[model samples]
Target: MLATFNSSWFKLLGIFTLNQTEVKAFPMRWFGFGFNAFGQICVHEELIKGVWSDAVNEVKVSTPTELDNQVDTSDCCLTTGYQIRASWSRRASLHLDGFVSNESCGKPMKESRGCKDAIVSESYLTLAFSDRLESWDLQKKEQTPSWSMKLKPHSSGPPVNLPLVPGGYIAMKPPLYRLLSPHLRAKSLALSAEHAILLTASGAVYTWGLGSHGQLGHGGLTSEEEPRAVEALWGMPMSCIATGGWHTVCVSDGGDLYVWGWNNSGQLGLPSQGLRKTLLQQSSQLAGAPCQDASTTPTEEPEEEKHEEVFISIQAFPALLDVTPSCEIRTVSCGCRHTAAVTTTGDLYTWGWGDYGQLGHQTFISSDEPQRVEFFREQQMRVVDVVCGAWNTFAAGVKEEVA
Candidate 1:
């Protein structure tokens, strides 16, 4: 017998099916619409409407474009000088545009995970894997034997790959490597141009390398060859950490953000006025200036005092930053001179160097404090991840209404 079916009910079901299909098909697309001076935006040629060729300029993007290539997974992606290397689960693709070199192509990496997980500096590329660590000289276009080291088995445990030695190992252990030996269980590592930081599973942070700008989180501007714990956060348990060109950031177990190091660009979320005052104070001290009595000095107005409290130029030690006063920060990432953070509610905040719109504020104005990027909120999207290039920012977000 032929039965009459309710067409209205069928239509409703079809609409629901279409919605689900759309959600699945468009699962959070990656938006990389920032600095592209060297063609690091990674969008398909057809997708790029205009180009910004200036060494440090922002791309005028009306909308977020989907990344051309699909990345299944990645250990990390590092950029330096004029090139970018994106590490995948099983391999890595090195992108070098004409701005960087004469050729523009993707160089397939070796099969090993270490080869895929790589870091780059102005003159060299270092790859780290489970078995060994290798270094390639970018200037010479040849591998250096002295720069490479085989993973050695620890006396108490299995083989562990040592951190990348910036220069080369000498007869004596570099101060940084010496400090790392005592703490054999390293949970994570972050590097910049001249410094390296290691976070232990127990929430301790050790840093070594160039400290000219106090990026090491120590209370002085001196480089250390061996890793040294950041005393300011000695007892606080940290969950994650990241380093920029000359700054450092870390999050505590309770989702508190702490920052220190170079504030020349206000990357520390502090005001430059305080830094100037600090420099003057140091200069006076060196000149053996006489100390003024508090009773003889004029009292600062309440508003002026409040302003001074927030205008800090340099924080040699880790200082707690209350950027998301009401929201807890889940993760943080740093660009060459910019900073980005993700809140538990999936909101994204950016600040610091924005000359190339790396701060993602829709404008190329730098910020001294963390500011929320309203693009995600305006679209009813939730940011799930954030990655920063030296002069750019990338974010992935999913629709809030998607089930």
Candidate 2:
């Protein structure tokens, strides 16, 4: 019986002309990266059609015009010469994945060598589409390498797994190599992540790859291949970083607030329906099923603002959070769908969709905005650390001692 099965399989394989012409696609190289025709940065590995397969790295198509191209006129870019400078000692294979914009549209023009001085920061996996990929010597002088290869004609590759130093080569997959080259588009760029922190030039935070729930700060959502920014609070530069399942939160310089992604049970300090139904299944599970239907309404006067059902999942755009703008947020932490934020006054607030008291709220409730959690109210805890989990929230702070 076993031999018959094997023989039958071999015969089927032979019908497709097992011995045909030699096929050579992307040779198994290490890695590659370059600008695409639309000016987005592209990356790839050592395989044929490797970047495109969802099973492999998440490589996708993005038009150059669909990105932000405005140069951040902030002191950071101006002071650094709009060029990324590299510390020779910090030469690591960096992969930066995100988005970039410029003032001009369509095609790129040559800028002065000094323009790249502003880019002299940390290591990254992939970068903005139009950013120039070059090397820096000990003296910080940019060294141009001579190599010829196709770029992403219209595609790019995974944004993580890059070494944090130099002397590494990036392998570019098809279509991507042909589309995105500094020779094609101007100041546009894109980014990706491999379970790491991705800091943008404009004080924004983007995270992707994996981490059950707390790792993405996207609530209790499963996972995402593309990148997303923490949108609750803007104009804050994050320093340290940490991640967990289904959620990811960061701390800012002066302490502000920002979050997005999942909100199953208000874990993100945002409201959401904890109910989950698979693509083929539908279930009506509710925490507080409001009992006000058409029958309950009195034959229609000016109807009150109808509350819409919230389905917490990965968000395409970052949602700005509602927090006391007057209170300076000192730190933030994310869990599966719950989040905690410490104010400068030593006060802590939490929200998002949580089923396991992850919000520290004592009970499950979908909080669409920031809410003060009683767990930290009694203690004048000075939060120093925060970590989020798939369905758990944890924080470490110094308890205020009675003087």
Candidate 2 TM-score, C-alpha based: 0.39
In model 2, which runs have C-alpha deviations exceeding 4 angstroms?
Answer: 1-196, 200-236, 240-254, 273-314, 364-366, 401-403
lDDT of 2 by residue, 229-336 (tens): 545444666653433334444556655444544455454555444432221122112434333332233355555855445555554334445577678777665443
Model 2: lowest-lDDT 10 consecutive positions: 11-20
- lDDT (Cα, 0-100) at 41 in candidate 1: 53
Looking at candidate 2, what is the lDDT of residue 356?
A: 39
Cα lDDT computed for each candidate against the true fold: 0.59, 0.36
**lDDT of candidate 1 at residue 208, scale 0 to 100:** 89
Candidate 1 TM-score to native: 0.66
* Cα-based lDDT at residue 373, candidate 1: 89
Residue range 180-297, candidate 1, lDDT tens digits = 4644367777777678778887999988899988899889999999888898899998998888889999999999999999887778888765334444555567799864342232
Residue 381 CA error for candidate 2 (Å)?
Answer: 3.5
